[model samples]
Target: MDKGMFWAVLAALLVFSLIVATVGGVRDAIVGYVMQTSLQHAQRDMAAAAVRQRAEAARQRAQEAARQREALQARTLAPDQQCVSGTVVTVRSNDASQLIRGGAPVRCSGRLAEVPLR
Candidate 1:
């Protein structure tokens, strides 16, 4: 080959290699950016799910507490029913009852046998 032709071929080859390397670098950068964005979106979704779970738990707890309160209210007793000592108030039939402690209305079904019936 002629010396001039060899030099021209060499120059063209160098330029082509550089272009290929630059394109490869750019592709890598774009892929990395996409991966980072996807990671962030996944993290956000996970956080949202955690928050929703906590909310559901709280709601369940509140519902349970309300059910317990209703059960307690249903257990209130009525007056004139005979009761025995340590006859807890849940077995009674009235709403008003003798104070068991510190003026606290006994809202149970049964009462102490010896205690005066309220």
Candidate 2:
């Protein structure tokens, strides 16, 4: 081939190679950007899910505490029927004998037995 034609062919091949490389690089950059965005979205979703789970757990704990408090209140004896213990056994005014024994009010007769310490 003539010198002029050879030089022209070489320049054209170089330009084509450069264009191919640049296109490939741009495509790779686009793929990487998409992957990064997807990862970020996934992380955000996971964080939101964690927060929701914590909220649910806190709500459940609050409900359980309320139930326990209500149960404790229900177990408490009335003021008239309840009596303080000297030490050994604690008794509530359930009957006339128990009221006299516990030194509780006569209105508390036929009450249920309850022990605060135990």
Candidate 3:
């Protein structure tokens, strides 16, 4: 083999090794960037989930408050309704979710109250 060709081949091999080393370094940097991005996304997702959970809790509390308000309003007779004795009083509401006290017709002021469907 010619000395010139031999030196040329050795130089090519050395150049390839340097390129391989640089490529390895670049690959490591890319892997680190991907891992960092993934971690940030995970943290963001957890924070979003926490916010959603808190919103759901607040909504449940609001619903419970509304239900309590409805119950309180239903128990008390309206100013217009004056229960008359010896007469079947059929109390009606637009919502149809009236709170009738007892199974037996509940007497609001004097007369009996109709049984609640609920």
Which candidate tops TM-score?
1
Instruction: Please state the error at residue 45 of candidate 2 in Å.
Output: 1.0
* Residue-level lDDT tens digits of model 1 in 34-65: 99999999999999999999999999999999
Best by lDDT: 3
TM-scores of the models, in the given order? 0.67, 0.65, 0.59
Model 1 misplaced stretches (Cα beyond 4 Å) = 78-118
Report the error of model 1 at residue 97, Å: 14
- Kindly indicate the candidate among 1 and 3 with the higher lDDT: 3
Per-residue lDDT over 1-118 for candidate 3, one digit per residue giving the tens place of the 0 to 100 score:
8999999999999999999999999999999999999999999999999999999999999999999776656554554444656333455564333333445445554422342222
The residue-level lDDT of candidate 1 at 74 comes to 50
Cα deviation of 31 in candidate 2 (Å)? 1.4
Distance (Å) between predicted and true CA of 39, model 3?
2.0
- Could you report the Cα RMSD, in angstroms, for every candidate shown? 8.3, 7.1, 8.0
Pick by lDDT: 1 or 2, better one: 1
By lDDT, the candidates rank as 3, 1, 2
Candidates arranged by TM-score, highest first = 1, 2, 3
Model 2 scores a C-alpha lDDT of 0.64
